[model samples]
Target: MYKFLLFLTASALPGVAAAQSADSDPAEAALAEIVERQDAARQPVELPDGRATQPVTLDAATITVTATGLGTTIQSTGQAVVVIDRKEIEQVQGADITRVLQRTPGLSLSRNGGAGSFTGVNLRGANAEQLLVLVDGVRVADPASPSGGFDFGNLLTGTVGKLDLLRGSNSTIWGSDAIGGVLDIATCGGSGVQGSFEYGARDTRFAQAAGGLETGALALGLTGSWFATDGFSAAANGTEPDGFEQFALGGSVFADVTDQLEVFAHANWSEGTLDIDGFAAPSFTLGDTAETQDTRRLWGDVGFAYYGNDLTLRAAYSMADTERDNFDPAAGSAPTFASDGHSERVQLRGEYRVLGGLSVAFGGEREWTAYSTSFNAREETGISGAYVQLGWVMGRLAAHIGSRIDDHDIFGTKTSFGADVSYGLGSDWRVRASVGEGFKAPTLFQLLSDFGNPRLRPEESTSFDIGIEQGQRGRGTHLALTAFRRDSADLIAFVSCFGATGGLCTDRPFGTYANTASARAQGIEAEAGIAVAEGFRLSAVYSLIDAEDRISGNELARRPRHSATLFADYEAAFGLRLGADLRLVSDSFDNAANSIRLDNYAVFDLRAAMPVSDVFEVFGRVENLFAENYQTAAGYASPGRGAFIGVRAAM
Candidate 1:
């Protein structure tokens, strides 16, 4: 893996080096010459709905693809969604994806400690494992994890170009884990040169570089970044400091094979090391132990897409690999734990226009997954699924319906379905409603681990939402309100083996995984944005959630009941930009039965930037401006009052 990443880096060095020269790069000129021969490959296709394929751009007013797994305008879709562009990310000057996501409505985040530590995310009152995360259309969940979830701590913001979040259940559109919502991330790519470097508190350093070339029917891009920090201690009671380091590399290529066929490929690799902290040791002594973890993640996809006047078809293959090792130097023993897992998927899908204002989509997918660990033997599983969906629109009215059937080797077969409708009231007002069913198959670890339960059933959920929105054209003003409810049954949880009998206790001998849990969550989300002046804007979002375990009647852990954010930004003709935001979270429980309490907290951030020339800019920001001391997780302290300054260059 290291060798592969090295080769990719070496291949792109000449272009990066040439970018630093005062004269135009000869390599770039050569690329142009090569592209000149492929000018007659791909052509734009017009859909029956009058939508035309164009160069991908970050225009929030236009459309998004994540909501429906197909192209649809934000205002036209019945689902609630938000788009965050690269410019908005830079305005916040944050390096962690979790920090950026916390500013959105109906989302909550908790971390074990500072940067690079274990982080948990809750969307619309759904658990972390219930939220699906996608990077460039590839699922990134770790099958080896107890809950088969993605870790947001390892996703840096330096290479992210766009983020699309759909807030509700749509398992029929995606797959498992969509019971919470979906976070779709797009990496940086364009026909230009761009990079940044920064120095901050705690001996921190950061650097990023990207290069791209596009001509005729072909385009290529590469981006890489490095980050390191002597982070604060992960445990509040420990004096030893923990640190983290990361390196990431990504590349993509697109080529038009013919007027109707286009081929594309993308790959990303990330490896990092993080310091770990332990709790109290024997005799009640604070465990300032020396522990560390090394983690590696790799993902790639390749496929061909064909576009016809009335039909579109796509076929693709993708895979994700994750490996991690944990060690304790203080104990002077071998690695304490390790896990390796991988997932591979193949899918074929097509969309055809059935009439003037109606379209239909059909697809089939097959997936294989496997996991290995130090203590457990390797295990594998497979699933196959097929689905169909219909979309229709007539002036102010739009509707969508979809259904899917998934067959698992052990769980037999299960079906899910969803439908949504929207009606536009005049030009500025609209109302929407949706209902959906979702299911999550047991994770490989959950079913095959030491505490395995081969007879466990899949978790199932039903969700519904209704909302109203108002938007003003050419006025930069929008307001939306939504109320949603979700009920889940047969959720998996570990149960003690004392008094257990028969096959349940035969697997683990200690505790057994069982379908002994049920839950309910309901929430209200409100968002508003307006142009305060010609160059200044203000936006805010507020969420109220009631999440509880139905059987125990206890509030879910680590989910705040009330959370809100307010943001303001301004830009001047003189190349100056200013931005600030405030985030507020109410107190919530840290453990089941609502016994442990985590305090409520508020954080403030400020940033400013100015361009000296068209190619260069300088910027700075202050996080936790008031130096507030807070903890999102018990015994874990959040960063306070840190300043970062950086310079960016683009050509």
Candidate 2:
């Protein structure tokens, strides 16, 4: 059945390719996500409330705050960063986070089933556990999880205003769990009100509302969203259906105590319930047994800032908590498994301009983490870290150097260093390169769970990347290419305890975590965007990766060797817009041993919007237009063709 769908989509490709003229090069439109703004000055624009708004020109070099916690444009920084703003997010209309993140060149995602299911994100071939995820500068990872990673499935794009995806390692700035990279998400905040409602296939429903207000030195923002779906069976061979329901709320407040000082606080809450199909234990076969999961998460932060003409100081306290419960009726159990994780953090940061064209930024942080499960004893750990970075910019050249030390109660200490340089080759061209080190501490569960090993060591990594970019704004053309490599060591993996080594105890028949894995990943990414015509634009991206486990001589699980995407949009009369996207992914193995193979596939989507007035608009989209059946995980089915329509209003 899937083969027929694949052939149908492949057959339609020739017509689209033939429509493009040789003179039309869609490089500028395609590379818009990565190209830096090209401004030559740092100016401050004041708002109506006498507050200064950071200056950001559309054509100016892309400025980044996640790389160094200091504002620096991509044209001047050596790190590879991709920025996704609210405008793009609105156009995509993604219900969840994974849909948006998978469009990036070097990022890949795997899901066990449909929306709200367990999802994993891999950046540049790195495991989900190796990356760090931050929401408004606060870490939201689950300390009780075996991998200590955040679940993308639970996050919605409706509340996000900006997303910064930084590729390559830079633990020197973000501390541990940055062996891959960083995903910094900034929630929506501003004076305005917007609301949306949608209905889609399979009894899917969505609704969202957001608003903000500012008066004098005080500002407040609030947002909420709800989603529900009658989803398909989670297992491939199952006939029963599963469903999901979720809700989220977020708010923030800020006040200026004095001219140079300000205070701020924010809180976020999300809860969800998911119905699932379970497999018969021991046989590993899908059955009619019913299972379900209930999840609740909360995050809060309070902070103060002192902004000076050439110096800035800030401090913040943050906390995050996550609780999950699983129930299985077939086992006649009230709750088969239940776990809770919490983390608390305090940080101080200072940045100063000590010399002309030279500035220094330094900070220190302390964190406490705890985990508890129904079947295991509660455990806790502490971590302390400090970092310093120096930045120098002169004419067309920019350079940055930084280092950090992280001390963990169980793993002792680990140090990392990183540096990057960017040079403007000419008015239309720029080149940049970066080299960095990264590390990850063992999660509390890995050290205290029943299958844990207390003596586990931290994983380490080294990575580097180089790239070149060229853009002709007047001609509406842009191009970018990047190559990167990463080597990791001492990766923690479960090992059988039956064969004891080095006089280690072997009381448990299962396995324990051990530092026994090493791997290397290399990839190339190319992006281009061009205006095909006055009313039409096209963008395309291609990525290639070679990731493997060195000791086992096996390819990394679920990391595709080839992937590409083509996007086209057209503006018509009467405030009408049309867009289409096609994505292609090659076959990949789903397990560590490279035994389970998933087939290659292509999926296409179509969307359209029409504005009835300045404040009202209607939009619709068709996903999996050809009903291409594919899977990112073995024994899991992808969504078939689905249609959705929605309306949005703003005041």
Candidate 3:
């Protein structure tokens, strides 16, 4: 692996040397090229110092592809969404994606321990399992998990270039597990070669490289990354140190078959090994133990697109496979626990213009999911869905109405409906509203496991939101406020049968899954950005969420009621950039009973970067500047003060 990485780095040295000998600064030139690409996609936002910057909030010119499953400007869609480009991503100066994502409104995250631990992301007060996550346009959820949710712990920001987060339910377009929202991640793309190397606290080492080539009718790209760290103890009271290591590779190919047709393919693979603490013998309490986990994931998709004067067609086949194994050194050399999950999907979609300013979108999809565990046999299920939508754009008004019908092999049939409208109040102001329905079928483990209940019902929800925006991006100031509410029914929950003799414990003496819970989540999201002065900018995001269980009337676990972030960036002399950010999270319960209370905490971070030469730049960051001790989970310990430095090169 090291040799291959060296080879990749050496292949790009010639280009770097050539750029270095140029008259212009290579760093500045690279920044200019990135800005030019962003401008071509959306309206360019500039700082008071005449430097280009990505906006913190969605503006009229911002385009979103996740909202409607098609490229549409924010002004034409009623759904609340946020977009983060590469420039903003690099500003964070970290591999952990959760660190940057938490700055967005209506989003929160909880990790079991430091990096490489199990991480969960919650949006708009909804559970992590209730949302959908897509990477490179492929669903990466693990079907073998209890809730079939995506884990963010292993997701590093190495190759990611863009992220679009749509904050509302829209199962009418995307089938299952979209009750909360959708997170769409796209990998880096462009005709360039870039790489970075870093060394940080805890003996951490990181390296990443990406290169892309664009010819007349063909475009290709490749990316690779490696990370290793001697992490701190996971248990709050443990003394032993844990560790983690990971390697990832990705590639993409796109070719123009004809003037109006194109084909593309993308693939990514990753493997990681992590040392974890688990329950010990005798006391059976959570603490330091000689246990470790190994995980491997592969995701890929092949698709084609055809463009005509007034019609567009697309088709794709995607697949994702995940395997996990847990080992205990005390037990034996063999893995104590093992599981694997696989998902395959085929989809075809098209859009046709019915008349002026009017168009219709329709699509159909078939999916198959299967899972196997050490103790349980392989189980599989299939689902098929079809949807149609009508969009109208007239003058300053835009509206979309859509519906979908899905048939599950075991759950029978389900239908969903959604509608949204947006109207421009003026050139710099707009108002929007939307209503949608969502549903998620039970996972294979929930229905086929030893403690599973075959009579479980699918979870369903109804959501509504309205919002208003004022001021245009790069125009000195921008602000947006949105309020949303969602009601869920038939939520799946586990029921323990420790002492029960009858009922759900007749045959299974451990536990059984059932749909005996309901919930309601309502909240307000506010965002603001201002050019404080020349060479400086300030942005703030706040969220007030009230998420509760209807049955117990208690706030959901790990869902903070009030969260806010304040960020500032300044461009100083000699092409130097400095940044600081503060994050505040209110206290919340750690369990359904609301007995374990997690304390509120605030964290601060500082970062800076300076150009060393035309082809290389140096950057450093201090995490947890105040060294404030805090914990997001009851038994897990969050990282304290840590410092890291890295160098980046582009050609």
Relative to the true structure, how large is the alpha-carbon lDDT of every model?
0.78, 0.78, 0.82
Best candidate (score: lDDT): 3
Tens-place lDDT digits, model 1, residues 513-574:
88999999999999888999978989898999999999999999998999999988899979
Candidate 2 lDDT by residue in tens digits, 195-310: 66678998887776666677778778886777888988778777776788887878988787997687888888988888866676788676545899999999989998776656
437: Cα error in model 3, Å = 0.8
Local error of candidate 1 at residue 337 (angstroms): 0.7
Residue-wise C-alpha lDDT for candidate 3, range 1-651, written one tens digit per residue: 763673467335322211211112221222233223323444344434565533333322255667877656666688898877666778888788988897789998888887899999999988899889998779999999989899999989877766779998888988889899999887766667887777898888777777778787887888787888899999988888888888888888878799768788989999999999988988888799989999999999999877665667778999999999999989999999999999999998877766655779889999999999999899999999999999986555679999999999988899999999987675467899999998888999999899888888889999999999876432468889999999999999999998989876999899899999999999999999899888899998999999999999999999999999999999886779899999999999999999999999999999998777887778899999999888888899888899999887778
Please give each candidate's TM-score: 0.90, 0.90, 0.92
Cα error, candidate 1, residue 196 (Å) = 0.6
Candidate 2 residue spans exceeding 4 A from truth = 1-61, 472-475, 499-505
**Per-residue lDDT value at 311 in model 3:** 68
